[model samples]
Target: MPDRNSALRGQRIHGQFGNISKEPGVTFREIKDFSYLEITLWDWARDSLRSKLAELLGIGDLPDTGDSQRLKEGRLLHLADGSLAYLGAAAPADILEVAITPEEGCVVPLGHARCLLRLEGPKAVALLRRGIREDLRDTAFAVGQVMTTDIGGIGVLLLRPDTAKFDLLVPRSHAIEVWRWLTRRAAPFGYEVL
Candidate 1:
């Protein structure tokens, strides 16, 4: 097994750093304790791969392009490029060893390559609106949805698993930049770097 390290290890200062707008309306922290597995299914192998995944992972159908499926351990996000990301407790080794064939699909471990950040609080939607130009209204983006977009030019996989949270999966290299940008902008709303 590879060593586990945090993308925002030294960058995340555990405390409120921004303006105390109505009692800290936002809080963020790196998600380091989950497995982020990526499965890229070739066009012709989609059905077989989905079946194999269902049989091996004991999970139901993957979400549609703009949605997410919550599981017991974590959640499954359907990426824009026809890839499936399972951000769960651990990689499903059985699926890798038995289900995945070259013809079926390929697995990529994104645990370390990406930085998962949990952003939540009352002002989460409001703060995200400052950078993400998406209609985040519950009626539009609704809970259990995911989208790929950019914040300050950094590509991110934004997942709304709950009504109050927006989990951002960012490239490892640019996690801190986002942290800084978010904290600075969250000042008015009051934020915590927990």
Candidate 2:
């Protein structure tokens, strides 16, 4: 079997601000520990809000139901209630606040937590399943399904934003170990550690 690191020999890295790294053809951005903010919208205004969010983030409008596309360049804005919204992003320093109204529910700010691990490659799916419990079969966990499950005995937020790729969320402290595990598991299949 090829060495895990060798497989990821040349790939561009794409990740958040802090964890950015230079890989051949891989990009690793550190988007862990983002502040969570909740916003409430008025009735029948969710679509408008979604539109505004997409525009602000440079992505397509969100669908009426199901999950939103993973913000490739920005943070995820999740609206939990009608007349309410939730925003979470990785900020450098002070937390950002957006004012809404009492009748519009609430916009609560959550503290820093969670680590993000993105694996991109043809063999990514096969490698990820080695440590995760959720069924990764195409028919079962289709792309865009966000699931909270355990991976290698660790809690993880698994998102299959697209085929041949995955975004994993875990506690920040275990990021390295998880990466190592993923690298090691992917070896047999020519897994690369980008």
User: Residue by residue across 1-194, what tens digits does model 2's lDDT show?
Assistant: 11112122232232322222332222233444345443556675555555665576566765333243555433453323352222244441122233344453355553334455677766567777778777888888777665667777777667666776677665656666666676556546553333
TM-scores, all candidates, are 0.90, 0.55
lDDT of 2: 0.51
Residue-level lDDT for 114 in candidate 1: 85
The best candidate by TM-score is 1
In candidate 1, stretches whose alpha carbon ends up further than 4 angstroms from where it belongs are: 1-3, 91-98
Clashes of each: 1, 22
Model 1, range 1-194, lDDT digits (tens) per residue? 46668787777878877677456899887777767777788889888777777766666776788887777677777886558878767645434534677677777877778888998999999999999988999999999998889999899989998899989988889988998888889988888887
Please give the range of 10 consecutive residues that has the lowest summed lDDT in model 2. Answer: 1-10
Give the residue spans of candidate 2 off by over 4 A. 1-66, 69-112
